[model samples]
Target: MYSNLDRPPLNVTELRRGLDPFFSQLDVVAETGSTNADLLARAADAEADRSVLVAEFQTSGRGRHQRTWVSPAQAQVALSVLVRLPGIAPADLGWLPLLTGVAVADAVRSVAKVPAELKWPNDVLVEGRKLCGILAEVGTTGKNPTVVVGIGLNVSLTEDELPVPEATSLVLAGAEVSDRTTLVRSLLRDFASRFTAWESAGWATSELADVYRERCATIGAQVRAELPGGDRIEGTATDVDANGRLIIDGRAVSAGDVTHLRPLE
Candidate 1:
């Protein structure tokens, strides 16, 4: 029962109208195969860093674990932003996904007017149903390297458009506003602020950590983590370590698919 509604073309002029200091360039395309891959290929370009590429519709979008992500055409906020951290300690690169998660939660709460929280590394959930997915990829190695962070959010999709039973859209969450443009602006605004603070502090600050813990829905939850190489563990998620890894039962999980268990478990 999906409607004939397609997202209106992103207003490139309005997006670039004032121009925030964090981003030097912003390009909105009518559509693309994959914003992450597209930006990754261009990461070496001088203008690629501090630049943004937003696709109105992603033909080949993906999520964690190479899971296919599908949404109604133009009915989501699908964009990738590039950043270069020059002289940044490589150890701190793990925080980009968490940082992006925090910013996405902030934007979702502010724009959608819903109670949104982060699911560990980078999933945004409202009432336990996923609303957004974020993927952070590192590209190139040098004094300054690029990390492209991409976020895909379901904005106005109807129930029939959901790609998974566990997924929900902003509209389904009773969001007060489902305008893609507004959500994009708010997300970029919040991300820019957090990113600037993180960069200014040389990635040694704890503000992002503190804020992430406060907004993280996974911490303190009994969970099961499916790690790479066919390893699995179940325990209560204690805290996010300094390296941004999920600490569970004295083990640090760098990458995994976490499933939150019920309270009685």
Candidate 2:
């Protein structure tokens, strides 16, 4: 059993009482391999729609590009939310992660009082240090499609506890509050509200795209996109197109690992 005096367990009862009506189901576990994996398996069930799973610790948490995400027990908010979208087109699904990034940045900004910005493709950064990582996976149940969006936010982790030198926790970033429960609740509520609005508008990209661009720090920054198959593109990040692809030097890139290039002296 993982125990930390500074980091207490989440209050599942309070979470359910406050968030149950908004989500199909709300659950919190002491430890799990990955909330995304667990929710993806549950997505096979029809009732898994809008399910929310928050784990106090994720043994094998994963980030984008098959990267491992690890944090000390009770030191972060490891959450995954499952939503089924039967009416949305497959081509437009790329916006899901971008939308999630917007919600996460907004939540962190509101609760943590930190200036959180989006690195292209959904990594949340505070003062150029990563504070959260988001991963969105797609699945199918019957004819409808399911999306499990996982978010791992650093909460109370000290500098030594960080998995990477470039990562920052809320406490380390001087957040006004680093309570995991509050942060998780705020993140879910914001995501649900934004997602519900977008879905109601037939998954439109106009509003979401505008908001994402404004909050994205990568836009207009010099970047080097390391694409799959060992190809790379280095140029300025101009904008995020209607399809949510990063526009690099007028080229729209759909998939790649992007690095912000520092200016020369």
User: What C-alpha lDDT values do all the predictions have?
Assistant: 0.87, 0.90
Residue clash pairs of candidate 2: none
Candidate 2 residue-wise lDDT, 1-265, digit = tens: 6588889999887788778356878888888999999999887787778998899889999998889999888999999999987788788888998999999999999988989999998999998999999999997834478999999999888889899899999999999988877887888889988898898898888999999999999999999999989899999999999999999999999999999988999
lDDT for model 2, please: 0.90
Candidate 1 lDDT for residue 166? 89
Residue-wise C-alpha lDDT for candidate 1, range 1-265, written one tens digit per residue:
2234555766777788745788888888877888999989988886668778888878899897788887767788999998998887788887988899999999988878999999998899999999999998897778887899899998888888889888888988999988777787888999999999998888774888989999999999999999999999999899998888999988899899999998774
- The all-Cα superposition gives candidate 1 an RMSD in Å to the true structure of 2.1
